[model samples]
Target: MTTHPAPAATEIAESTSDASLARTRRRSAEIEEQIAADPGRFRVLTGDRPTGNLHLGHYFGSLLNRVRLQRAGVETFVLIADYQVITDRDGVGPIRDRVLSLLADYLAVGIDPDAATIFTHSAVPALNQLMLPFLSLVTDAELRRNPTVKSELDATGERPMSGLMLTYPVHQSADILFCKANLVPVGKDQLPHLEQARVVARRFDERYGRPEGTDAPVFPQPEALLSDAASVLGTDGQKMSKSRGNTIELGMDADTTARVLKRAVTDADRHITYDPAARPEVSNLVLLTALASGRDPEAVAAEIGDGGGAALKRAATEAVNEMLAPIRARRAELAADPGYLLRVLRDGNARANAIAEATLGEVREAMHMAY
Candidate 1:
């Protein structure tokens, strides 16, 4: 017979808890370092509402990075956020179609559905159930302060916001935590929501949820994957947005892309330089030129200085056209193959459902509602 010394139950419990905390800290540090420098971390979640097609801003800002993450071995979860669109408190359609359209773009741009899972917000019942307990963890005051909600409301001039609009971030928290996402790729502006997710996770553990043992945090506090690229501007030099009628869709035709670039705002001084503060318009053009052409922005600026802002705009336009030509072609090819896109979304949704089912079961059991 094998003999072993019996450690006290208290001693055993403390050892396990301490080890778990240490593991969380170590994993957090490692993942944060990677997000700060590298982008390959499993459990990264990012997505958009089906209000519109993606644009150039999304590509440089994150779409490409998402594709990179999926290929690099991280299991990516892309939320279609179909329900988020109805938050406008106005227009909506049969989400089933729009979701498929969005999936087309996702796949066309190399978002391998086989690699990344795409899910709809409305489809996951258990995930949505989280909003109930989740709401109890936070207050109305915090929700009112959500900058995204405030901005959307201000822009739309739609006051008396729908309950959906107000509670969207809480819903967002449920989305991330439901999957136990550890890393969320986001730009600077979206940090607040991630912070809220962490707070909700911490609150859940503190209130009723457990980490590994008695009374510990349930969700891992995710870190922001800060983006280096500035937000792409529309032709008017403001943020590129569909509402502003200035966005260039990722799948737009070459002729259309060129036309939009032609009208783009350039520096008034005529000559191009890298001084963004003194010459933001022309600098913006130079920046776009550099990104599109895969060359040094300053070098492109120097070459164009020989002519003027018009010259810089022309060069930028050409570079943008070239870069977009292939993407547009790929989008066209994918559009023709609608069946493939459908499969991608279907497969993604299944995977997301699986993840949600597991977490949702655990959550219900913890709260004594499993029955």
Candidate 2:
């Protein structure tokens, strides 16, 4: 009998990646159909860590989709992941201000506080309590293998990985399952994190729910709600990140935005084109213009063809400033009334706590620990 060698690690990893993408795409389609057919059946949980002011990347990537979901009548929960700021970073700098700033950004972008539940991670105790039992559902090796955690740790450079950082996926699982959120909007890179949440939900149900003769599962295995929005790159042609200082913040004035766009990197070749692979920097600018102006990127590129990089910068600056004008005005109004922002947070936190408390009660009962 001939023995075949095991597949190489890289080969296996690639295969796994492809399979995961396929599954996510398939499930996203089904969920989309379900949402359209019965808009009331799904609940969405999506959020951002309060690191800094909101940028164009946040606007185009997740914020717009969030508005679409809320308008679609889906029950939505937006968690301000304040605790997550320290996951890979040193300290939470001006965390309170950032949280309020995030809230203002949401409102400016048409996220109605009355329609959706917007809450914070630190405010929801029962939500965090779910982390205790969830931590036991997965092993150390499994946690280490989580790509999101590994990437975050790798980004931390010489800093030692903290315990919380290592178990970040479990914390995220708590974020999703605590509110029984069945739909999570995620990009392709975040699919693994959502998969880990699904694992926790399934394992918890199989081990704890069935033995109690429970009529319903303790947690819902969340599905990925993929966004078709292309990833927004920064002016420097890298991933748009606040830490890099390459983002056009939503609150920036028109002059500041113009100045930032003037410095955007582009090729020496005068001709403008939208070949993302070859001319990424130039293509990025074109894409920003297209997104802001509601035109096709390729068409934008074609229109700016032979106009060169300077013309592209001018176009992007104009389009972005025009697009953000109304949002900036609204944000300014919100900023003037800090008291109102606090009220929104207070109400959202209270609502979130009540829901989390109920979920935890059920969890404790299922584990036979409720006295």
Candidate 3:
């Protein structure tokens, strides 16, 4: 029987050449090696949207890595992507409180504000201005072809896509390039956004930069620094997400954390094992326990052998609460001093504005727009 070709498959395969995740992974390893050898040579940019409280998934996924990089002597720039909250959501939802809460979370997790530049998106006007020139470097077709953008749009359902949503990747380029950050920490899903940033940097240098080989490029084509942490699953065996009600938020108290872990889904199998493929729910619990307790997952499962789900839940709850205790205590202390948090943001904003203005000036000179 005659049949039409699969358009979706074709698009994905064609897109894979430009955004090959495998290629990024190889490059990530090389970047990691170089960073290890000479950490001072790199500047990293990473951030989060202030949509809600940071969670355990975020802790293992990105926060811990940020601290590691900072301690390794790499310069870190942490952005509170306050503006991105509206990319898909309808309202900002107490954004001010959320930003403060996020700052507290970062501090409690060992993100020393003294060492890292922590700023909000709205605070840096020049950074946002870079979006105009960066947007011109890319095409509408390229933006629409972005798998991440398409997936996000699909998630928004029938809501009409906003101009901001359509140009999310471009804005992200501005985020990376405005600070002239040479490295970015990202998960696989975000590689596409990072790739778009690299493309913008290259195009801008080619079209408006100093004569070929006469001067350094206007911006560095930032490289991806992928995390080696295992994927963290929610208690329900699904991706840990706030909207899914599965996340163990960093703001949760010990008692609340225990209560949440207690109801986590586990299989009927009386024997506990760490086979993620065969028993995702039970394995997820064991994984959480292992991560928190700093033990291997298999060992954690062996310790709970024949104890069934009860033993697993108890182990996870205790381990998690113990690990989070100091963080929670520090968070409590920080919460009591709102003035300190404001000062941190204000200082970071001032520093960020200075950097963005400097970069924008370079861009203007490169394009002959400087008067």
Extract clashing residue pairs from model 1. Answer: 270-309
Q: Give lDDT per model, in order.
A: 0.75, 0.88, 0.88
Q: Give the Cα error of residue 357 in candidate 2, in Å.
A: 0.3
Least accurate 10 contiguous residues by lDDT in model 2: 3-12
TM-score of each: 0.85, 0.93, 0.93
**Which lDDT tens digits does candidate 2 get at residues 160-212?**
69888998989999999999999999888777778788888877886678325
**What lDDT score is found at residue 177 in candidate 1?**
93
Minimum summed lDDT over a 10-residue window in model 3 is located at: 1-10
Give the per-residue lDDT digits (tens) of candidate 1, residues 6-51.
3321222232255644554465567656655655545888998887
Model 2, which residues run further than 4 Å from truth?
A: 1-16, 155-159, 210-213
> Residue 197 in candidate 1 has what lDDT?
86
